[model samples]
Target: MSTGITPSLFHILESKIGKRVLVVLDRSFGFEGVLATVSQNPPGIWLSDAEAVTLRSTLGNPYPQVTNRQDKSELFINLSHVLRVEILH
Candidate 1:
């Protein structure tokens, strides 16, 4: 039995492989990384060359600032905590 949605999801993910993406989590934090791989058993994603990022409004600047460009070699994100994903150049 299949709802016929999983393949489309996988296709989208596959197309994004090696591209830069921003993944926002349920928490206030998000990450920017290169899409490495995905695991279906537990519904998680692996990101290489990952960096932690957050958006915060500064006093002087009305626009939210992107901060915390901390570098990380690799990261595994549990899909349950993900809020949304955006493709970044």
Candidate 2:
């Protein structure tokens, strides 16, 4: 699996550290949190106070809802599993 750390993605992720973002995974799982770190050696994203959101599957469904409360303050997500990243204002 590709780490998904393209030059642009890396730059964008790096810049978003310490900021809020919505990370979308391959299976439509989402995480909304403050970006803690972006590792290049073993490409991954670390999120602080992250909330896992399960995306809606059927039409006319409600918006994604927070499904998992992260036990740890920091969450490390492998870049290979990241499908999309959206920086929040």
Candidate 3:
């Protein structure tokens, strides 16, 4: 995946492809929080605390990972792993 600064919308849409999405953990949000996505089933997914930790480590480490914000129990997708972002209503 390409690195650099991208938009949040790009990442949100990427989560739709059934590819394992790497969202940022929103520390501000509480556990069992929810996120918005453009997927056919846009309820998004949930990430456990352990999973969030793993994601954080994977980002800075030698892995093709994405960063995210964690809110206790909820995480948002990082914009880095967004390979191809599109705006489809």
lDDT of each: 0.78, 0.77, 0.36
- Residue 31 lDDT in candidate 2: 82
- Which 10 residues in a row give candidate 1 its minimum summed lDDT? 1-10
Candidates 1 and 3: which is better by lDDT?
Answer: 1
> Which candidate comes out best when scored by lDDT?
1
Could you give candidate 3's per-residue lDDT for residues 1-39 as a string of tens digits? 334443464465445443333343342221222233343
Ranking by lDDT: 1, 2, 3
lDDT of 1 by residue, 5-89 (tens): 3656667887889999888883457888999997665677789999988866766987545666888779998776787877888
Q: Could you tell me how far off, in angstroms, the CA of residue 82 lies in candidate 1 after the best superposition?
A: 0.2
Ranked by TM-score from best down, the candidates are 1, 2, 3
How many backbone overlaps does candidate 3 show?
A: 15
Name the runs in model 1 displaced over 4 angstroms.
Answer: 1-7, 57-65
TM-score against native, each model: 0.77, 0.74, 0.23
Enumerate clash totals for all models, in the order shown. Answer: 0, 0, 15
Q: Taking the tens digit of each residue's C-alpha lDDT, what string does model 2 give over 1-89?
A: 56555778778788878988888894557788899988886888899988877665546655454455444466898888777788888
